[model samples]
Structures are given as C-alpha cells and as structure tokens.
Target: MSNIQQLPSRQVSNRGMEGGRRSLCRFLMPLSFPWVLLWVLALGGLVLMPGAVLAEVPNAVPPEGTYEGEHVEQPIEFPHDTHADVNKINCMYCHTYARRSPVAGIPPTSKCMGCHSIIATDKPRIKQLTEYWDKRQPPPWKKVHDVPDFVHFTHEKHLKRFVFDNEGMDVENVAEVCAFCHGEVKKMTVANKVKPLTMGFCRRCHEANDGPFDCWKCHK
Candidate 1:
C-alpha cells in the first residue's frame, strides 16, 4: 500500500511539470521566426514612412548661381536698405502688383510722395525726390531684374505658389523668395542683378523644385 501511494505522488509531480512546460511554450510561441519577421517588417515600414512623406512635401530652397551685373543707375538714388531693412517696410508695400500681375510694376510717384511728402524732407536724397514730386514727374526707375522677352514668367503665379499657397511660409518673409533671382536687395542701397538669370540657371532651379519641364511652360 505504501508503494502504491508513492507511485500516485510521482504521477501528480510529472503532470505538474508537463503543465508548466506547456505554459512556457505558449508564452514563447509569438516570438517564433515567422511572427518576429512580420513584426520587424512592420517596424521598418513605420520608420521609413515619414521620410517618404516628407520628400513629397514642398519647401523654399533658393536657386543657385551668381552674375556680376553692371551697376544700374536710377534718377533718384533710392536707399532700399533704409526703407526695407532699417524702417522694416515690406517689399509688397512698394511693389504691390507682384501678387496679381505678370510683372512687378514700379511704384508710382504718388507712392513715394505719400511718405516723403513729410518724412525725411531734410535729407539730400529726399530733397531730390521732393524736386521730382514738386514738378509732378515720376522718377524714371530703371529695371534691375529684367528677364528675356521670350520667357513667359509671371510674378503672380510664383508668389502664389511660394508665399500664399505654401503651407508654412509667411507673407512677411517674401524678400527671401525675391532673393532667389534678384539677390539680397535689403543689404544694398541700389538694386543690382547679382544672379545669373540664364537658361541653365533657370533649368537647374526648375529641376530642383520639381517645376514644369515642358518647353511652352516658360517659352512663348
């Protein structure tokens, strides 16, 4: 009878060991090769998805290349630095047609007199401007950034894409967009063509920004 009781105890211990082994196998089953591989692929997809999304998003990367253009002389030696940088005047405030027209038209004589009629009347440049205003004549402001006649470029479309329609761009920083082709005017008293506005220069920028490549897109 004692032998029989010892046999029952041994059987009970064996059953418990078998149950523990089954529980351990159940816990480790999910970590098997196929399941682990699926998890790894899922994690890799998560890691790479953001990069793909970001690549598709547009950004303001200025064009490259420079040219030493001749110093253009204007009727009144207007200080662009003084108005744009020091006084913090917006470029659009003076060149208002840039947002709606093909060309960024020069500001009228009235626009100049609107401010200089009172402010800084004593300065020599201001005095010169006053003389023009008194004579009721517009200062013959020469164009610094003139593109080829064959090129069908529009300031309105470009500004809309880069400034108004751009997701994160601010209207206050429009000078940066202007600098892409016009150079940094805020630092210069007189505007100069510091960029190589050639076909290659334009093509490189278009390629970089994923712009339209069709010939008629730019050519008339």
Candidate 2:
C-alpha cells in the first residue's frame, strides 16, 4: 500500500519538473537563437555598412589626415561684434550691392578706410586694410559664405521678397540678414560657415515660408 501511494506521487513530481523544463526551454530557445542572430547581423552590418561594428575599419578616406574643401578663410579676423554690436552700422553700408544685384559685393578697402582712416589707424588689422586700398586692391577677402555652384542664389530677390529697410528689428535689415546667414559678425574674427548651407537645410526654411526652393532658384 505504501509503495502504491509513493509511485503515484513520484510520477506527478517528475511530470511537473519536465513541464517546468520545457516551459523554460520554450522561453529560452526563441530568446537565445534570436540573440545569436542579432550578434551576427550586427557584425554583418558593420562589415557591410555605416556605423561602428568594425571601428578599426578604415573609411573610404583616411579618418585622420588633412582635408581641404573649396572654401577659403580671410586674412584677418574681422569681429562682427565690434562693428555690428558696438557701432550699430547698417549692413547695406558694406555689402552695398545687395539691393538690386545678383552678387553681394565685398566692401572694397576704400570703403573700409573711409571709416578706419579715422577710427582706428594703429591696429595692424586696419593697417592691412589700408594697404589694400593704397594698392587699389580690395582685401582679397575670400568668399566664405556660399552655396553650391549649382545653386543660383541672389541677395536681391531674398531682400525684395522678405527682408528690407525695417530698421528697428535686428534681424530684418541687411546687416541683420547677414547675421542670419553669416551669423553674428561682431563676434567672429574670421568668417566661417555658421550655417551648414546644405540642400536639406535650405529646403526646410523654403517650405516653411513658401519661398522658392527650386534647384533653379540658386543654380544658374
């Protein structure tokens, strides 16, 4: 009688453990197999694609070496903070061509010396600007702020459509507009790409304001 009772209890215990093990395996098999596949796919992706799977893998170009884009830098660092921030000058005063022209003309040294001739003669920065004028050569200020050659952008149309002589508002005038695209000049000693000036970047703003974003608008 004791053996019979024990036999029934032992059978139940064995079945219960087997069920538990199967349940655990059921949970683990799917989870474990997928994990291995994930590692494989991740390895494959790195070897086959864009991120850090094979971090040591060299890029199409070497990661550490000199690279030169088309854009060039100015000879002297012209701080926008001093002129725009301190002097409260108009933007059109220098980039005087913006109102009706396709090209926003760089200020000739003569234009600069017209003021620097009196205000700060001793600064080596001003001295160079003066030298440019005396030589009849405008400072060979490189065009730092530019879009792709494919894009035919114009200061004339943008100002006519959106910006103008609204003096009180800081960002509405040409000087302010310069700050918008070029960034706060008074602060920059050397003009740099403050804006990424990419196609997507241009398109985002164009769509927002219903501005003309056609590739033809910039690329001539």
Candidate 3:
C-alpha cells in the first residue's frame, strides 16, 4: 500500500496558482524596491522642498580675462555709449541678424539713415553717414572682433543659447550676454576686442559652461 496522499484536483489547481504568484513576486522584487524607493523620495522632495525642485538652474558664470586690442578706425566713429548705454537701446536693434544669422551683421546704411535722418543730422558723424547715404555707398565698416578663418563661430547660435534659451533671463538685457566676448560696448565709442578670443580662452569658457568637448565644434 503506497502511503503517498493525493491532493484533490481543485486544491492542486489552487496550489499551482499560488506557486506561480510566488514565482512572479520573486522575479519582480528586485526591480520594484529601487523604483518604489525612488518614487517615495521624489514625492517626499516635492512635498518638502518644492521650490528647490521647481527653481531654474542658474546660468554659468561669464568668462574673464582682457586684452589690449589695437584701435580699429572705422569710416564713421559710431557712438556705442550714446546709443546702447544712454538711450538703453538693445544690441539686436542694430545687429538685427544676430538672432537669425551666423554673423552679427553690420548695420546697413539704410538702418543708420532711418535714425540719423531725424535724430542728429547736424552731428559730424551723422553728416559723414549722410554723405555715404547720398552716394549710395556702404561705409566699409571694419570688423573689430574678427576670428581666425579656422574658427567656426555663429552669433545666432550663441545668442540663442545665452539669450533665448536661458531661463529667467530678459531679452532687454542681452548686452550683458554680448559682453561675454565683445566686452562692454555700452561704455565705448567703437567696439574693441577686449576679450582674448584665443583658443585657450574659449576652451576654458566651454569647460566651465558645459560646452562641447569636441574640437570640431569650434575648429574647422
């Protein structure tokens, strides 16, 4: 007489189902604990310190170091201080293509005339500009911040990063961002290359600001 006890079919089915549930729980246990802990901590943080969670990440500090650039003579000495500092004009008002194009394009004669024709027609600088306008000739503005041919800089992209995409930054104060490389144009008569704009200078800034490490980003 075999002594082995046979379970009823119904009881066997229930036991098998319970064993399957135990197997499933064992498989999921490892993954579930960490995820559940993460959720709990995240919820706790949101409830206890909502401001820290919601606050915008502050922008990186601006780069430093200065260079004594040679004076660049332009056809007409543009009064940057009068326009940018005194009048509180936005940098993009004149450098209109900065937000859309690669270069912060030199303002056309028409743009100068739009203001000089009515604002300060008697000023010698304005008179010189008027002469150029009369002759329908561009003033052959010399670039003050020219980079090396190997450098691949785009004003539009820089502007988009430091101005447009930055949270808690106001567009009206775009000159502050412009000052990163161009220096304080609001204090000068003409733009000068105050920042070194050297490879090391740029690399240091990139490292500080979480910019790309790839050399191809800036070098052609």
Candidate 4:
C-alpha cells in the first residue's frame, strides 16, 4: 500500500516537471519571434539602402562650396577659355588683387567697362554688367572655388613666397600654374569646383612640399 501511494506522488512530480518545461518553451517562443524578425528586417534594409543611394548620385559638383554635391547648370554660360585663354587676359584682369588681398576680388562694373565699352557694348553680358553698375550693384558672379570663411587663406603670403621673384628665379611663371588648384581654364566653360578639397586631399599635397602640416592653418 505504501509503494502504491509513493507511485502516485512520483507521477504527480513528473507531471509538474513536464508542465514547467512546456511553460519555459511558451515563454521563450515570444522572445525568439521578435529576435528572428529583427534580423530579417536588418538584413533587408542593408541590401536595399545602397542601391537607392547609388541611383541618387549626380554628375557635377554643386555651388556654395560642397565638394561632392550636384548643381544645375548656370543661367548664363560664361566661357573662361574665350575670356582668359584665347583673349590672353590675365586672371588678375577680372579677379584683381588676388596677390594682395585675402579675397580674390571680383571686378566692379567700371573695371568691366574698361574693356566692354570698347570690345562688345551690344553683347548681352556687357549689357547686364552695365545695368548692375547703373544700380550701384556689382554682378553676383557666383563663386565656384570657395573655401569657407573660417579658413583664413592669405593670397599676399602665398604670392610673396611663390610669385614675386627675388633675383633671377622669375616668379616660377605662375600664370601658367592655373592647373595646380584651379584646374585647366582652357577647357572650362561654366565654372565648377574641379578638385576635391577634402582634408585628405590637402594633407597629401602639404606632405609633399614639406610645408606646415597644421590642421588649424586650413580649418582654423
């Protein structure tokens, strides 16, 4: 009789153990469902996002000083080759005081009239320049090669070092060195940022020249 009673107690304990195991599986099922779902969603996102980004890439660099951004073509196509290359007008002819000032100064209307008044008074560009002058405003010649204002670049220092000759060096003929930073003006029609002026790009050249490799010099 005692053995029979003990057998019923053992069966009850076994049933409780089975019940606990079933409860554990039930608890884990909910947790595992979300974990499996998250992995699937993450993998799907990784596969899809890159194709979308690649499809959105642009052709040319944008204005307002973005290195990799895109731009719509300008309203008026100002061909630099015609004005600077063929005509042999120096860069300082339009952008005067590039050697003296921190700003590569854009010319006022009076400066344009020095040539336009005689060269092509009837041309639309000349007319536009004149109109701006009449209003005491300068043409907003959109800046293509703009470093940010925080970067205090002095044209005076660089020109004094590289351009002005001391004795017989003859200034390295820097007018021909337009391709160094500003790419070939010979081929450009509408102005664009020709170089990627990233930190890595600047460092590579600075390292070559044995120049001061200070981030504060450019980044300020």
Q: Model 4 over residues 64-141: C-alpha lDDT tens digits?
A: 112332443653566778887677677766767777887767676688778777887788867776777788886666
> Given candidate 2, what's the lDDT at residue 83?
79
Model 1 lDDT-worst window of ten: 4-13
Error of 4 at 90 (Å): 1.2
Question: Which stretches of model 4 miss by more than 4 angstroms?
Answer: 1-76, 165-173
Write model 3 residue lDDT over 1-220, tens digit each, in one string. Answer: 1121222223322344457768966755766778778767877977788332222224856764567799999888988999998999999999999999989998888998898899989999999999999999999999899889999988898788888998888898888888888888888998888887876567656657877766677776
Q: What are the Cα lDDT values of the candidates?
A: 0.78, 0.59, 0.78, 0.56
Between candidates 1 and 2, the TM-score winner:
1
Error of 1 at 211 (Å): 1.0
Number of clashes in model 1?
0
Question: Against the true structure, what is each candidate's TM-score?
Answer: 0.72, 0.60, 0.73, 0.59
What are the runs in model 2 whose C-alpha is more than 4 Å off? 1-72, 165-173
Residues 21-100 of candidate 2: C-alpha lDDT, one tens digit per residue: 68866755665777778867876977888422212211111111111234356776676667765776676777789888
Candidate 2 has its poorest 10 consecutive residues by lDDT at 57-66
The better candidate by lDDT, 2 or 3, is 3
